[model samples]
Target: MSELHDEVLRLSGVGKTYNPGTPLAQNVLQDIDLRLARGELCALIGPSGSGKSTLLNLIGLLDSPSAGELYLQGRPTRALDDAARTRLRNRAIGFVFQFHHLIPAFSVLDNVLMPLMIRHGKPDAEDRARALELLAAVGLADFAAKKANQISGGQQQRVAIARALVTRPALLLADEPTGNLDTRTAESVFALFRRFNREFGCAVLVVTHDPRLAAQCARTVELVDGRIVRDAANTAAK
Candidate 1:
């Protein structure tokens, strides 16, 4: 695949094990081969201890695989140094976790621009404009000047979503992003993801335990005991 429309993430014979080479070594994932293409919205569903979180970390470049290879945007990443890995992650991947992780003291706009500030020390006009645009897209344009602690739970999560998209990453990874919201709020958050995936043309891989939420994704990848038991299209999910 080429740059604009290439595989966002590719795992070949990927495996992860904790305490490797020790008597207490435990393999968590094995031979996990998968490819997520550009603009695809996929759900990763699995039970507790199924290696779902572990796999997400590896894919997000927060962790490395014990075996095989993980490629992001056609580039192999296992051998990259800490600095290189961090750079790559910031440039290519966006993450939204269960908790918003917003800085309570910072205004919503500043929070959304945090990544850019980290990279450039301060954001330029274009950067600020993009952040505002994302906040608008998430339905939080008016809340930009307010502190994160001042917003509702759902609103805070929407700010997190805007923050994640500020970098215009090629891939977006979300782990239980809507887990803390009410059913209606959860659905709205999920809808924002879908809308951003389409508008930004970014591939999305979201981990979710809620079957109802998972059913909304275009594809489902079920993991059990660290293995991909099923990877199939869910046409009706849309």
Candidate 2:
């Protein structure tokens, strides 16, 4: 297949400035040109003040860029209306945050089904089955009936991963998904990302501060002072 056919995301001259016309204006990201192909797993690394999260937000369509355009699955995003953006985001993108953000009131199974529920009112039998299967994949099959608040922090994060994957999005954007866990737990959580990236063929862009974790990805993109300074394939990736 051609590059266009395999392209899941592209950003062309993209920039984000918080308050463009005032003294308080701050440029969070600049000239971010990037492309993620189908099933590719890449890591975004940067210092504390860098624009890593800002870039992820733009790619995830949670925020609009201040300049240039973004394309998701070859469709331009700058011209999309609010409803259209929501529809496209739901259909093509999945997000996993450091906080997991599971609903404490819902059961684990219901939590995984939230994305499907939000997209189409109530979920059907197939949706429920898919959620269960994902839970099983994450080793949470036995905890499906438990409330979200009842699970350990690591388990809650697993639920978040399953929830993100329930919609089978073409691209998965993770913003510091392992930032809160212990070393062992973090590796386990990240392993799930790799596993799903391989099995489901979803393009993954994960923001991480850990060099060890970044080294595990096939490609690494480094950011500094709101600009990408390095984007190269890892020769020793495992």
Candidate 3:
């Protein structure tokens, strides 16, 4: 396959500006050019207010870019309508946020099955099997029947990861996934991302402020003042 065909994501001169036509308009991202191939593990690092969150939001299809095109799984997203964007995002991208966001009332297994249930009302036997498999992979099989709120924060985050992967998305976008965890817990959560990337061949892009966690990614992209200042491979990735 051609290089383009191998890429799971591509941003061509992508830019984002809030309140675009007003004097109060603030440009959050500019001339952002990037690409991630299948199974590539990359870390996005930048100082606060450097636009990392905005960039991830755009890439995750939560918002549209104002000045350029973004292609996800080779499909151009600039002109896609809201419904189309939603559909594509659900099918091609998975997300893990700083907060696990699992419903407190739901069982751990139910949380993992949420995505599938959203895509197709009421998960079937196969869906349950997949959820159980993911829970086991994350070492949470024993907690499957417990309420999400009953688990520890780190365990909840693992449940979130399992939920994100249930769809088998082509790209996984994780925004500060381990920001609230302790050092040891953080490392374990980060490892789950690497494991899933290798096993599932999904392109992984994680935004993290932790240098230790960032160093583990194979590639790193640094953003500053709304533009990428550096994007390079880590020679000593763990």
Each candidate structure's count of clashing pairs: 0, 0, 0
Say which candidate scores most in lDDT.
Answer: 3
Q: How well is each residue in 1-238 modelled by candidate 3, as lDDT tens digits?
A: 2287879999999999999899999999999999999989999999999999999999999999999899998899999999999889999999999999999999999999998988989999999999999999999999999999998999999999999999999999999999999999999999999999999999999999999899999999999999999999999996
For model 3, the superposed segments whose C-alpha errors exceed 4 Å read none
lDDT digits (tens) for residues 128-231 of candidate 2? 99999999999999999999999999999999999999999999999889999999999999999999999999999999989988998999999999999999
C-alpha TM-scores of all predictions: 0.97, 0.98, 0.98
Candidate that would win on TM-score:
3
Please identify model 1 stretches exceeding 4 Å from their true place.
1-5
Ranking by TM-score: 3, 2, 1
Residue 2 shift from truth in candidate 1, angstroms: 10
For every candidate in turn, the CA RMSD to the true structure comes to 1.5, 1.1, 1.1
Query: In candidate 1, residue 63 scores what lDDT?
Result: 94
Off by over 4 Å in 2: none
For model 2, where is the 10-residue window of minimal lDDT? 1-10
Model 1 C-alpha lDDT per residue in residues 1-238, reported as the tens digit of each score: 3353477899999999899989999999999999999988999999999999999999999999999999999999999999999999999999999999999999999999999997788899999999999999889999999999999999999999999999999999999999999999999999999998888889999999999888889899999999999999887876
